[model samples]
Target: MLTISDLDYRIEARPLFDGASAQIASGWKVGLVGRNGTGKSTLLRLIREEVENPTAQSAIRLSQGAKLGWVAQEVAPTDETILEVVLAADTERHALIQESETATDPDRIAEIHMRLVDIDAWSAEARAAEVLMGLGFKHADLARKTKEFSGGWRMRAAIAGVLFSQPDLLLLDEPTNYLDLEGAAWLEGYLKKYPHTVIIVSHDRELLNRCVTHTMALEHLKLTLCAGGYDAWLRLRAERVAQLESQRAKQDAEKAHLQAFVDRFRAKASKARQAQSRVKMLEKMQDISIPLAERTVPFTFPSGEEKLSPPMLVLEDAVLGYGEGADILRKVDLRLDPDDRIAIIGTNGQGKTTLVKSIAERLPLMAGTRKVPKAIRIGYFSQDQMDELTMGETVLDHVRRALPSDTKVAQQRAVAAAMGFSHEKVDTKIEKLSGGEKVRLLLGLMAMEKPNILILDEPTSHLDIDSREALIYALNDFKGAVLLITHDVFLAEATADQLWLVKDGAAKPYAGDLADYRKLVLQADREKPDPATKPKTAAVETKPVAKVDKAEQRRLASEKRKAASPLKRKAEDAEKRLTKATAALKKVDESLAQPDQSSDQMQALMVKRGELTATIEQAEMDWLEASEAYETAINA
Candidate 1:
């Protein structure tokens, strides 16, 4: 629970929040959304500062005893195992356990044990493992040292630690930026069931819509909180904008009529009094001030004049990888026509990139035939293409260098403008540009080739929701075939008509849609066995435990279970209902996302979805209550 009242904040005299106020209820999952460079992250920093050093004049306030948690940065590479790092995140538990070893007083030892039971410390490792697995870590990887993982995996470990800590007020900024589709989807479900208040700043539309209970719009130097998801917020904002426009129009007409009357009658003595009255009425009228609509720059992917023949690119039973005898993907049979729009889907490290690279001719097949017409052109955009850009060079410099030597200055500027870079932006150095700007620049360079097929890998990673929508529009409008690899499900759903699954050393057509694929991913996570449940191999041989010690351990365990049985049963039942309700709601949401449904069917599904949403809300409340009661009973 947090309250921000009349918050006024600025950066170098530029206002980020002016008279902004919001109340976040306990247990509410709030999705903070706004365009890029809109100070969303700054707001989070302010909240963190307020929580850390409370001042009487500060605008942000949290409930007493509420702990705030966030992943400030990626975990530094260390010798600690992933599991140990996550387990140590719960400082209270770790300190208590450490103190228990040296605690000589009986009262203090008893107090530690009671507190551990209250916190459900017995299941801490299991919960940590679940979070790690959902975030794309293998069971074996839990024991691996953090120094052995890459920077991205290290960031995920940081995220897992924060999640496992379960702070009362959790703050997540762009949490899904490093996640693959599978990890993102798993995070969505996990957050839906999180027990405490959450304030997440993200550009991920699917995660916002499916996970958060409330949408917090940060725009025009103000904050507006709305019930429901991003779609609901959009609908409400649209209606408000229309209403304001209508009111303004009516006010303008009234003012015009009053002005005409006053002008005509002010010249006549007989109507002079009426003219004065009309003038006063006009002066008293308040102007309806509507906020200016945010402008989004469009992405252009122009199609070439030449038409390519069918099967413009083909890979027949190809073994694709970095080199000979090092095949990452094999038995791949794929074909791309000039008009195809395909999306590649799979878990991370499943050779999705390898498949795309092979298709784009960037990687040669080791043992299979590849066919392509010499006239066909392919433009490839790698996910890490930004790294290839020279930071010291300007956008115009890159554009000019990428274009033909004969291209005129005007034509170069025109190409840069088409990629959403204005004259000022074109001259700006690459190091000064934002991630989205760099992505736009890369796209501009790619589009200059006038290719028949585009192979784009994770192109939307740095784009905001509006920019992503603009890209979806451009991709659909472009005449060239598109082969996209992205973690953004909304982009995939909007642009791709066919799904290609790259898994298990092969690339093939997937029979289901994006919704079905999401379900499959979530189901896999649910079915995964918790690593904590696995038996550990002993490093050294040990004698069996004494019979008396074993009997005492069993007696204590049985007593603990007996004391919590009733409340535990209630919690289990509530959990079951919540799971069922959530599944039903997901089904309706999936149906609502379909593009080809009839109007009547869509209306029916909308109603069903509304009902299911309410049911889920109530079920969530019941589960929370029951779970708390169970914990209290055990602690007692």
Candidate 2:
């Protein structure tokens, strides 16, 4: 069992954990959750004994004889081979084995041999190999020097090393950050069957919900332990919040009743005793403390055009790849409608990214014809933007370049604000920004286009859970088509309705849910192919609609139009309301900017401005909701 007895920690001058106490059982898998700066990592460091607990009486202790496993954040390039580095995780066993081999004394050699046997040192290499393969490393790659691999691949090696150690407790901090979808799934399964304790810090909601036995949340500078996984914790938390709010409301109402009685009859002789009693009761009443909320950054993607006709894009017998040599994807026939929400998933080094690039017009089709409506605007977020972003340019300048020439600086700032770049942060050079911040800038740039179709490739790579949720929220309200190529199963499951699997030069519709698909991928990867197996056939293409006469299709469209007319009218009305509210908000802001105003006038203007801001948010949210409903009805 792990116990924290009033442990406190601080960063610089700010206290993160103030006498926070929590207990975790021996075998429980804990999910540590909180906001970005709430110090999830710091808590992990504290557990690892790297950070000093400030409370003198605090005791952060684990069970006797318990061993810990921690993966390093950065694994520097070394002369060691990947396999050697992994095997090095068991330093004690390795040292014993070396001593046994070189020892001249028979007694010492026998003792070392017994210790090696106890630790199962003979299977260490095999275990390391298994972990390496599970993390997407080939047999040939295991002997390769760690320095030869890219940063992401090297991170995978580091993860493998940590897993191979198999300590009593494992500290996995975003273990899947650099992992492929297949690798992530494999790791999830591996952790499930693992016998040891695990505490993970991940933004993958599904992973957290599925893997964790308990949740330890750092809220309002205190660690609160809840029994159960992410979903259970959320359910319990919501109920608690509701109960607290209801009780507080009741208490306030009673206090108000007594307050009024005291106010009215305090000076009257007839009811002096009763009024005094009421006042005393009022004084005795204690205020119920509401739960404190951390600062929230509200974000929304810019709204797309109201109208887009299908099919928005199509490819007929197309070949996709970087160059003319060997194609990564061959003879792919695909169509995208304005209502399509497709997620592309596959193994690493496969054709998912290639397909997205082909669709985005970043890579030319090597073979067949492609067609797209001239009026169909596309908003694309590419993985390559991490390298393509100008190091010298500011965030605001990049947004300005991407936006229309007619767009004002004020409008650009609004878009930046939604992107989480304040006026000050906006001026920072791109080179000084973090990977996640860069991705946010790119997302903001794409959002500003307000395109009718969005084609994204690994858009969630560097994003945290909050940003990922914000993106998902925006996508849910988006009326246009979304084609997402991502390894993030949580994001994909939340946003996509259709799943496409890309493998072995073909793209096909996946016939199952994410869980089933993960099984298929992992099974395929782990199981060795047999020569006796039959040759594979082409993937069976499933058309959205069966072939019908043009007249019949037209009739169906006409019927849909008739059914959707009311919703369409409501959506248009909402759009108008939003426009008017925005105009009113602008006028209020303009009035506030004027100098030499009376204090009372300024106060009223501020109140009016606040009201207008709320009005705009509600109006826009309503508009999106109505628009999405109208679109859904028409497509239904």
Q: Which candidate number maximizes lDDT?
A: 1
Among residues 3 or more apart in sequence or in different chains, the pairs in candidate 2 whose N, CA or C atoms overlap within 3 Å are none
What is candidate 2's lDDT per residue for 412-466, written digit by digit as tens?
A: 8877887888889988777557667888888777777778888888887666777
lDDT of 1 by residue, 438-549 (tens): 8998888888888888889999878888999999998998998999998888889989999999877878999999999988888763335364544244469788975678
- How big is the RMSD of model 2? 20.2
CA-lDDT, candidates in order: 0.85, 0.79
Steric clashes per prediction: 0, 0
TM-score of each: 0.81, 0.76
lDDT of 2 at 7: 71
lDDT of 1: 0.85
- What is residue 355's positional error in candidate 2, in angstroms? 2.1
**For model 1, what is the alpha-carbon lDDT of residue 493?**
90
